[model samples]
Target: MSSHQSPFTHPNDSSYGSLQTPDDSEQAVVSEEDQEPGPENADTDSTFGGSLLGCDTDTLASYITDYKYENGRQYHSYRDGEYWGPNDEHANELQDLAHHMYLMTLEGRLHHAPIVNPHNILDVGTGTGIWAIEMADAYPSAYVVGTDLSPTQPLFVPPNCAFEIEDCNMEWTYPKNHFDLIHIRELFGCVVDWDDFFQQAFTHTKPGGYVEILEHAVTPVSDDDTVDANHFFTKWGETVIGLGEKFGKSFTIWEESKARMEQAGFVDVVEKRYKWPMNGWPSPQHRTHGDDGGKSWKRLRELGVWNQLRLYDGVEGFMIRLLTTVGGWSYEAAQLFLAEMRINLKDFNTHAYLGVTVVYGRKPGLSRTASTETSSTETGSTKTDSSGFTVHPMPKSNFPGSYRGMT
Candidate 1:
């Protein structure tokens, strides 16, 4: 099929359209002339003003008295899936590539089955319901639940797996004493109050429960080789962080989350990290390109190009203001920038520390607690075998990716 052909029409993905939420769910109208003062906009009810996150006016008004979405380049609305989910416009090959990379470098952590079977499990911020669904399939005896703010989950679910649409920001309302394993992955924008959220998770969990959080460690990289500070992609990380803060979320949530879990009195905390390529090329020479890595790059292009337009249309004000008031950049100019984003998504040369980290804390068992009745450490606790996969500790150097050959 031609690249332009609609993949939605394909027999396997006929429900893609129905599954995706339409942009029509809510639309923002930005007018420079009628702009309200920031203090007034934020001081009182902000029903008239708009939020960058997808919550409607009533929802925003109920929480923040007055909040504007502007943080960095992108504004509030851009975070919504409709605004940024343009990944479909790119070649489907990239989509497959991303999934493949996920299966590879990303999926290894999931391969290690728990030495002990968990009766109840929670997959926090589960995307596409893939991991949760698979886990359900693996431990059919376990009750698996996946939760997200957006109601984008498929209607169908395995008998053991259930998906719920609820904000992780709100305090967890599960029974006071429940849940054996709580697993969260790639919840970059989904978790706002990591401290409060995890505290609640700890409380509801059974003694001997397990909590796993997987996240990406994002810090800027610098090399003797001068790269453009203004390189849009390089600074794009801030956009990801900015949008998250607007929604009361944390992109780099590991440190505080650990302290919170420990404060909740959980024992046996362990953190493991891994690095993966963002693009197909491993080095300047491309000497060792994993077949799957090549495919992952194609998916990178598609996922990226769609994100550009989303930032423009999704943001609450920044994009609208730049185009309307400044007149410095035209719509055509914006499209060109987006085109550049697509091109750079596959660029791999300078090393980037695109590493994945998993932090786990185990809920202590009642019998074990009684047996110890003293120290809080798990030194005497039974240690399970590491998830039968290649594991690496945190990178000593900042640039962990192998893209840079000279290094």
Candidate 2:
């Protein structure tokens, strides 16, 4: 790639790189289910036949036609005027960088679900298809399918992995009781109906399967009260929540994901919350011990830098759309307002952080006792038989005082 090449000049894994400014002629095409034919049709004809799906050009266009452009970036117009995020190449690359940064925070793994040997996986809102690709690599036997409104995934992927253009708000096309693991991430502003979505997810999930939701609380919190009532970040969060309410979506849905999953008939629902520092502020609690037995100041600083960078590059795209489309602010006014927000983002002394939550639930099947006993025996428990070697037993399941570890 050239020094001035776009972050998406080539198809690759989710990793960090500087995003180069695109020229006037360069743009990413958004795919909607009901777009009228135009010049993009001709462009699609020449650009999509050799894609990973290996379908004809017209067939590919059929999958990705409805779209609108803003700030020289393409966005999905599927469901006609819904979906708040962009589907452009720059946005895709930024999303991939965020994904990679999140993997670093999670030790390069996807989720905390205790699923084993899952044979069928579904990745909802699979931006860049990086998670699906990594999952396919981790489980070669699993058939991984990533679905999104935009067809922005790479053309080449693992044999077991595939990408589909589908609006999750609409009816799912996959067969019922099919997927062994259903993973959803970072869909705060996209999904309109949580009940309908989870009901469909429950119906599609196989018995004993798991559905995991990973999302970050967009509000930034400060420890020493540096982020006050007048802060732009705080106001930004308030505006997002208010906008979500007006649009019939909830930006704070992750906070109640466990209860929602349980309402959808999932069992053993567990929620884990993690924190990511917005910047390096020398906070001992947020600091990590180095591998060489010293304070990992450099690592912490890098994480802070990446976190701030991801936010700086990301906020404008979504914020502009929100302010203009929903808030009814002019583009110039939105940018003028966001300028202060960007300055606040660069303030390292604030010691701010974002709360990330990972919620996992199992489709109801066996009783908790049976499931625990089966897991305990499979994991080599202390129970033994008369033989010299350690034996496995279906020990009588003992209920615990608290359902902490059992879930």
Candidate 3:
């Protein structure tokens, strides 16, 4: 694919085709005008007219008014309509911290791909565009593009990096086979069609280019019996999985992504799994030789504390409205459930953890032949004996979104 050749043609000179709601359940016209505003389009509702995270007015309004606010947190008001995730200042701050968590999980590396000296990089669903900015700074010569629904990204990004308002579910407009590396993360609920998403990724990837997906199971897991079937955390997971099913998307994407990549014709697919401890009980990194329980215990307690704090607001920011609006729970009921969930998170004895999967695969080269035998591999070792905080391998027979035993 030529860098100069575009993959999609806009329906209108100043706008693309109508913006389909996130779940593809509805449609509305969303202007795709240039980010700059001129006198002719000034004050038009077709474009955003107010300052949003320092984004230009036109960029702010380009999205359909699919926005809603609850409890001081802003949310995407588009279809599948239950994204309780926030796009406010606090959310952005948590995103930055979450980026650090990802780095820590990956052992301080940005990504695990072997690509070298690539010029073009695309980050799909690049919330806050923090990864793009950091990648741009690291790879000075590469032009990085971050695409997302909201314009909450910083205005003073590196010159090599730029942000675009895009829906990953739609036909991408970038040149096919142009990006050296494409990255997507935490898009569990937003994408309705995983197969098409991977197909598009394959099409836009340069021959021999790499695409990586970083996602975690939204459902909580516990190796020990501490997290009972009736526990609030377990119920919360059930509700989230149920909601994903109701909307036709799957929340347990990481569990099925490897097979999806292979099905999409990607080669050399590799998957790595990590554990995200809900509290300090499952973290082996924070332990050391027994002192008087002063420094080590404090550090471990801090880990648990921060995880609790992040989860407290994070779960509310993602579930309160989702449960009330989509799950038919009343506002008061949602609040009560959230309060219980927060308390459960604070209880380190539960030993709950979420599985984080990082998978990367390459587009086959024009001259290379696809091998049918053992085309992919999983590098993550299953640990079931580590202090009862095990990270189980995804079952080979079961995939996400099947809704088995979720109710």
Candidate 4:
């Protein structure tokens, strides 16, 4: 694909701004004031109780193969109501789109752990199992295992890759100190207790193994201040963060995962941050420069288009249940709010972007007795992997995409 083209875009499609610069005369810049009004007085105490199955573990285990249907979406029955997102085909497609977006952001690198010759790899909450399948392909010798609450993964995968219907929130049954790398991505609002979650990762990861987490901030922001606190899109983010808090699972993982990893007895913790523009807003810069300097801008525009498509396609599956169950909004009210949010999201003038943070840390080697010692001595030190590639701290930028920043 060309640097400026998104894989999701068709050759003749102009809706994604494939043929236009950011400042094209045809492009309309809709200011927040000019946009239609959002839903007002949304019922915060609507009588729409959620569709949570209040069954015990034994009862759920009997029908673990079943899925709960609500709001025209399917959710995992194993841990009903624990996750806000759905497990249906639409959700799965969005998951794959997100996987591709992450690849685009990382420049096609599956991971940043610098792992060499991994023997066993574990992908937590693997969703559709695309990453695990790719990893299995990348390392034929390595046994790749993907665990998720839903059995949405494809039946045919690489010989070395396997999918398990499991929930990461519960106690893990995997062997201790086994996996060479434990990879997690985009599990922001799903996790309730991150400390215990990372502790489980630490316990299951082998000595000197690595655990990597990839999460994007839930809120949207703009460097040029085009989007403000009162914007409907901004309110959508604030509402999601608030719902997460009410559900006891904060959407602030991007800001908290690094420290949580260190506390979980992992060493060499590092965080790399990137930007996911909300739309093709950055494409104009590419056309303006028409030089090598425009390459990065072009790539950003492509990524932004992908990001916008994913979010726009995923808004219903993402917020329907949360609005009704956690936020106590009626189903109709939730739909109205989501409709307004979608309209705001389509505004290219907003120039909003979501911040992505990839945090990776290594478990202490078997020779090390205490994690405190490792943290004090080698916390931020740059180290070279066996492949002789130096791992340095990536540059940081002033992008506010986290829940804390929204506040």
In model 1, the runs with Cα more than 4 Å from the true position are 1-100, 106-115, 217-232, 254-260, 284-337, 366-407
Q: 1 or 2: which has the higher lDDT?
A: 2
Query: What's model 2's lDDT at 317?
Result: 77
Off by over 4 Å in 3: 1-67, 77-83, 283-305, 366-407
lDDT of each: 0.48, 0.70, 0.68, 0.74
Which order, best to worst by lDDT? 4, 2, 3, 1
Over 239-337, each residue of candidate 4 has an lDDT whose tens digit, in order, gives 999999999888999878899999999888988888877788786442222211223766777777888899888899988998999989999999998
Return the TM-score for each candidate structure: 0.54, 0.73, 0.71, 0.73
Better of 1 and 3 by lDDT: 3
**Model 2 agreement with the true structure over 52-139: per-residue lDDT tens digits:** 2433433435435557887665787555457777887778878987786566555445666766657889999998998888888777
* Cand. 3 TM to true fold: 0.71
Per-residue lDDT tens digits for candidate 1, residues 44-111, read 33453333232243353233222123223321222242122212212223323333344445433353
Name the lDDT of candidate 3: 0.68
Q: What is the lDDT of residue 225 in candidate 3?
A: 67
Q: Give the C-alpha lDDT of model 4.
A: 0.74
